[model samples]
Target: MVKIYYYKEDDSPMTAPHDSGEPVAAEELEKLGVFYKYIDSQASVDNLATERQYKNRDYITLDGATFPGGEEALNAKLDVFFNEHIHEDEEIRYIIDGTGYFDVRDNNDRWVRTLVEKYDLLILPAGIYHRFTLTDDKFVKALRLFKDEPKWVALNRIDGNTESNEFRKEYFASLSS
Candidate 1:
């Protein structure tokens, strides 16, 4: 099941209703500008490649998989992304196993913490200030999506980023026009 939590950008939990109840359809998430999909969890470890194989001719894709190194390793990577950073390209993942949270910003700049589990495919728009973390179990295996070979660099918000300067937000927003 997928869960989405609304929070403060600083990572503080929201006082109001954060968990928006049970997982809903990806189309529902689309309304909130999130791209999500549910697939076969028991599929092959390298499934995302096969999955992307059938994309329309005009749809170009380049991606790879990630196996979360349990708690310690996840925490190490967390120190990078969790600094509340933004990527130049969309951050996407297809969960092969385990669970984790992708904390993104709502239009109002508050955080929306989305919980992704096995079979869940999550796409966080580029330039969106967000963070990532695993659940208590400290386990996760996922297929990462990319437009091309990724730079693997996240421009942290702490380094002089402002709410109004999200280029990827406008980039995708324009596509919807």
Candidate 2:
């Protein structure tokens, strides 16, 4: 089952609900902006080739079925987009392959790094400064889903305190490990 964290206009900032640990049906996926889908690792590999062919990038081969370039491209195309800053609306995503990291600042002022892999899902509410990075040699893909259709916004260039940014530091530590 897909877990959803619903927030009304008057509700407080929300956190991702716990997963029911059940598989999501395809029919339900159409309604929600985010849902998880699991594909055989081998099938994921084949799909990558197909995607590359469709994009006319034959020279590019996906490593372990991960498509960071594709994800980045799709994200770039979204109406509102930003990196390293807080967003104004809830952002959701479903991991479709490999693994990726989401760095988030919780209400407690503690930074949290969530490691998402195939079939994992994530939801981030507004006003949380976050960033994403893919692990090397990990072929990961995810659907960038959003509640607001026109949610892309470019963040102004600003720096946050690295030490205070717990999520960011934890993610970097994982890379080194």
Candidate 3:
């Protein structure tokens, strides 16, 4: 069950926000310019992982257990990689196991914390401001999708004002309405 919650950047309630796992569908996410799908079962997740093919893209998996320091090392990697940034390539990921939240800004520039769990496949388009964090589970195995050998690069814009954020610019048409 993938759920999304909107919050102001300044609204620091000082608590975790993975509240309700309300049923959210792929079509609903598309309205916010995101593509999402939930696998039928663990069998499907395994098949997808083994086949390593999606639509037309290739996917590669990253496992926390295989890292040098295991969970700690993997958390460090995720922390470094996750940030308020936009990418030139679509950032697609499948949660093979564990859970995390991907906070993506909406048309109003408010953070939408999306809880993605096992068997969840998410496709975030290029040039979207987003970040991620693991839950208390603190461990995740994910398969990353790529059009080519992935050259991961992100333009971090965490310090920008509302007017200057690219999210505000592109979504103005919808926001203005």
Candidate 4:
């Protein structure tokens, strides 16, 4: 099941949740411009592809399918992914297997963590500060999507790049409209 909650501010493991978990509703997520969908796990890959094509995610790359260097390599990738950052374009992912948490900064600047599992499709609007980390299972297979050629650039918040970013401005403007 998909779970959305306010992330606890602490030094706990990324996958650990707070006692309350402060659940968030789907409508709240929509207001933040986060799109989420759940398809039956039994659905064929072709069906998922077709649905994605309809949404303009034409480029797809699978990660965690064949980890040559094993879990350590996957951990390295996740370490990079866990950094809070914004992308010039939207970040899209279709969870092919396993579970993970995506922490997105809301309008109030609070962290909203969402749990995504098999068959979950999540799209973070361009310029939204977000990060991802796998659950204790330490395994996840995801199909990253892009509209054109894949560009996996993360403008990290630590770089102070978000304030002047065009996409970031547009995203905030969209919330007001």
* lDDT for each candidate structure: 0.61, 0.44, 0.66, 0.80
The better candidate by lDDT, 2 or 3, is 3
Ranking by lDDT: 4, 3, 1, 2
Estimate the TM-score of every prediction. Answer: 0.67, 0.43, 0.67, 0.84
List clashing residue pairs in candidate 1. Answer: none
**1-177: candidate 4 lDDT, tens digit per residue:** 679998888887665664255899978889999998897663554575566563344433224546667767877877898999999987878887788889989899998889888888888999899999878767677777776667788999999878899999999999999
Q: Candidate 4, 62: how far from true, in Å?
A: 9.5
| Tens digit per residue, CA lDDT, model 2, 111-156 | 3445567766565544455655554443455555443354555332
Q: Which candidate tops TM-score? A: 4
Off by over 4 Å in 3: 8-15, 18-28, 41-75, 159-177
Clashes by residue pair, model 2: 1-22, 66-139, 66-140, 80-151, 80-152, 80-153, 81-152, 81-153
Candidate 3 global TM-score: 0.67
State how far residue 37 of model 2 sits from its true place (Å): 12
Where is model 4 more than 4 Å wrong at Cα?
Answer: 18-20, 41-66
Candidate 4 lDDT for residue 135: 81
Residue 128 lDDT in model 4?
90
Candidates' RMSD to native? 6.9, 14.8, 5.4, 3.3
